[model samples]
Target: MFRLSSLIGCTVLFLISCGTSKKSFVMPSAENISAVKFLGEYDIPYNLLYKNTVVGGLSGIDYDKKNDCYYFICDDRSDNNPARFYKAKIFITPHGIDSAVFTDTRSLLQPDNTVYPNKKQDRLHVPDPEAIRYSPVLNQLIWSSEGERIVKEKDTILANPAVTSIGLDGSFKHSFELPANLTMHATENGPRQNGVLEGMSFANNYKTLFVNVEEPLYEDGPRADITENNAFIRILKFDVASRKNTAQYAYKLEPVAYPANPANAFKINGIPDILNIGTDKFLVIERSFSTGRAACTIRVFITDLHNATDIKNIASLKGNSSFVPATKKLLLNMDDLGIYIDNVEGVTFGPVLPNGHKTLVFVADNNFEKAEKAQLLLFEITE
Candidate 1:
């Protein structure tokens, strides 16, 4: 009887120990991050040519930890060259960003084992590459393309946005089955032109995937302007193993930063990229550009889905307020930095610094224009 009683006591103690361990384990979150200090900026010369391809339109960037290098996707749309990504070695020091050297370039392949053709060649498959992330778990690189949506009186070229996995060598792997709402339609019912699948990141130890749109869908609401403050964009969650979008949440965008030059030019504000800091928490980049403005307004915000309602099943968010959107807190604004910020579109967490603080990097899209510059900015995270 004593032996049985001792055994039972040991089992109870073990159970209590397990419970304590579980309770003590705290998940890492954006709350732990306090602020970020600007480190330095590096600008790649305009119209730099490498491997016979123009090195511009660097809209998306990701760092490969194992290789200690960076991959930048060029949103050339096959106009200058075949749709491609470039690998480079960026040198970062305590003082600031030293320089970036191009190492290699690879053409992103299609399922047909051919590179994406330009619009004049094949209007249906012209890829507008935007965001990219390197997955150590899958040992592959995942990229997003905001597919074309052109509707002419006689010619309609519509291609669905895509999130595809590719081998490290840039070979096509597979694609995730996107939700139905992402479909492109000629009418005003689906994603707006050049607004789908702007940014993506892996979360939950690469088990879950998150991709966001550049703007609100037609059914969601009207685009962000000087008057509207209720434009809602969707952040989609995908189960990596299943390669399917599982859930989605709505995120409201701020109004346009500034009015257009002629009061009706081009003005826009939307999420351009996002990075996962912890469980359901992300660092989002909201880029605002107004016509006739010399530079863009770039802001970094940290958001979480702790109390956000899942809006995956909801058809439209035009006038709906029944669901709570993700909670957001501003982290940084480039305007306050007193520096000219370009069209900054990409954000990613870099390697830790010697002081043990984390590093964050942002890259700008030059649009292959001589007027704009391909810029890279570095920041050190403060706890």
Candidate 2:
């Protein structure tokens, strides 16, 4: 039983509400966080170079300083009947993109390149992946595939994404079955096109797995009007031992109206990634899409997620600008970027520079476009 002093109106209380499985679940509290600053940009730049892009897009990103270079994954595949996975090296800077080169160019396809052993039926045109991370401590690149197909139809389980560990050479070293309940999510708006759980980042010194929900399944009601409740982001912390999500932190990406959209036309967005921006402070990439437009901008919130376990209503994020960074500077549109890809998928923190300042890095999912480019943007922050 947890009692919270209402920061909004009357004193609201929070109690353990039972879950679908008869489990006790307590909702976090409502918080009034203030807006923050960008702290300027960390200077790292990168570009995308690939032989084929029928693979479509790249979603998640991770940096492995152990090898002195940054790594990323692409869910889109070559246009062949049997598609394959692609990867690249991202070098980024604050100014813009520098270069992105695809390496370990291989195929997830089998002999005759016609079988996807991961699934039994329904040939995959290409896998729509949303998450990817490299664990230097583990010497392995961990990634999550948001899109997977099944022939039996009955085998449909909200999300059955796989967590594969790839070697330095882009070879599969270890593959683990991700707990469906903890990793995968159901797309709500389009009943036919369901977007599964895709965001992946490692935190707690690489001890806990932070998995976030992009959007909810059919539960989103209707996409009639641009509403606040539609924006959702859940951060799931996994305990390697129990192999279960130790903590589930869910929050609504609150909408803020800036000079860009005077009618308050813009909706709130969720965290594409989270990091320890400062010594004790954390920064979450709060993002959202613009209506009738292809571009989107994401703001930064330097809040204490450890203390944020109390945020209740997602719509309540309005007026919390003190905790969020400046708007319209990070991006003009979500789908459109200064680079080839507007879909910037993953983000992670790199090692501390020799000067003692920390480096913040972001990676873009190329959507595997021959013309489009995958980018890795790096920034040096003075905390």
Candidate 3:
């Protein structure tokens, strides 16, 4: 979910299929996983104030194994406060997520050491912060910003999307060099607003990074609708050391789960966050929401790039059949849990349970809505 109003891989193997040819495949150990057990949920009181800042739009989250804590990027866009992230400690018991306490908050600073301003202050630089990841190797937090694209206003503003890393204290560290395609344009020739650069994660033992756009770019194809089952989005890979995009691959997005009310209300289905589980493999989240629906439909899937074609140089993917998209398999659907699922945008591996089983945690962005509740859900990976 991008708007404030909308309450929104591991083991690669090579195989020889034909006598004279070789085909690559990824068979992650997670494929053998038997079930996902829902533990419990904790709601961060609506608009809970911490460090004098209103905390609600928690869009992206990452587990800091070294510090035994978590870092969450707020999709605040510097509206209520400067674009920022929070360090928090979420205590998880066998029964559920017991409690959560905010430890610290830091404003993401620009190269000039100033906090990002709101659109009203600087329309060009106002950032729509979406996803964040903690790089233990660099001891920094990397985040993505869906920069402004104001076409309706008299003054045109086009702040290209960005991916940047910051020091532990939120000081500027480095800005990634993005490709030309990610730049926002005046016409519908590039990324759609609020649909670019949403999910990111560290892969290949922190040597490589992966980031994906929420929806397809204009040149790629059409936005996902109730009947568009083959909508495609690009996932960009980066060499962490160089901080440049190395390759890009297409991933198919599932169709919109439900039809919008009144036949034209707001509705969408797109990826919000991702997690690296093994080499070249990841866990992806597909969130779908439509107007007049009581809750969002969230699906967790596993995908890998072993057989996927790199589309970095391909200008368009519409009706293109020369490339193969990453293979995906459904793992879990939030609707099956029988719980009220909000706009879930983040997912990460949590601390191991006392029973020795690994854990998975998900967080929801409330969009700071008074009627909505910010949630933290826990689950056990029973293999």
Candidate 4:
């Protein structure tokens, strides 16, 4: 019976249906994703920028460009109660890369290998971690544990791959295991279907370890998964001295017109842009959560890894290409790199750019935030 202009038009139609129902993570008009001109696109120009960040942001990043400095980790628990134990290392510059002043603290996750043996076995106690890398002849430190929960659909959360050797002063040497189920399938459609694995890279001396699996999550319009297939790129290969699984390659992310169906492709989800680019060549980072753009594609393989038989297979390789007419064509198209990420979880490759070619980096793992949003997007692969 109230008629104050019909109670302000029913409170303006209840605030326009609560603002179209809480979906504003930035879908502006669908294909309007931009973030690759930095100060030119994102505008972080202040003195050219570069100050701190030794271990304040990193959800998943792995770099061992023969040793320039990189082996970071930050999945969460500094205050959430796992107690607090993040890994670290940083200080490489061309323009952006900082995180190294760590006199030495010691907390690289450890619950008990010896339970702390003497307090240095690379320490321990981790969960829901993202990614990290480094192997030098078996020096150790090749991890991955992309674990997350809360599903109404398909559920089968399986992610486990670890190995530590710890030394540099933090201590911890020789931890093992990485080969059995091999993990990272993505979906069959049930529990909480998955496209999970978390990016990683290492082949020069890390024996062999290249894993990246994130691609799954759609609304049907980002290009519509081309049409709709399944969503793939398992590409596993772990030996690291008999850890097993010498080969296993799965590639399915060739979206074009749609209906590609591995099951209906489109779920690299995010965070995995690995790189090795040499012998069997490797440099994978294809992000396009529906045309938002983010690709570093380049994977030429014929693996034999000396002999490991299971080269699984991933032959023809070469980077991504397509950005018609140039000028970002419509706010989305990648050549070598593109960053304006909302969900770019991890990528690694460093050292060798003086006309030699090689220095690509990327990290984004905000899942430590649940819905997702923790960034560390860096780039370089020129020459």
lDDT (C-alpha, whole model) for all candidates: 0.89, 0.47, 0.88, 0.43
Q: Least lDDT summed over 10 consecutive residues: which range in candidate 3?
A: 7-16
Question: Tens-digit lDDT track for model 2 on 46-115?
Answer: 2323464343354666665655565555564333323344455554444433555556454443223342
What TM-score would each prediction reach against the true structure?
0.92, 0.60, 0.91, 0.27
Order the candidate numbers by TM-score, best to worst: 1, 3, 2, 4
Model 4: residue 125 alpha-carbon error in angstroms: 32
Candidate 2 local lDDT, residue 247: 57
Off by over 4 Å in 4: 1-71, 74-130, 133-140, 143-210, 213-225, 228-234, 242-245, 254-341, 344-383
TM-score of 1: 0.92
The 10-residue segment with the lowest total lDDT in model 4? 320-329
Q: Quantify how close model 4 is to the true structure by its C-alpha RMSD in Å.
A: 19.6
lDDT of model 4, residue 325? 10
Best by lDDT: 1
Give the distance in Å from residue 254's predicted Cα in candidate 4 to where it truly belongs: 8.3
Model 4 agreement with the true structure over 1-383: per-residue lDDT tens digits? 77899999999999999988854221001011122222111111221212222233354555544545566665543333231124335554556555443332334545342222211222223244456665554445655554443333554333333444454433456544544343333443211223445666666445566665554323111221554554434456666566555665444454542122354444333325555545545545554453333332222121222322232433211121111110101222333344345555555554543444344455544443434444454444322
| Alpha-carbon RMSD to native, per candidate | 5.5, 14.1, 12.5, 19.6
Q: Write the per-residue lDDT of candidate 1 for residues 1-383, one digit (tens) a residue.
A: 37988999999999999988752222123446889999999999998999999999999999876678999999999999999999999999987899999999999999877999998998888899999988777789899999878888998878999999998778999998989999999888789998989988888877788999999999999999987669999999999899998888999898888998999899899899988888788999999999989899998888998799999999999999799999999999999888889999898777778988878889999999888979999999997
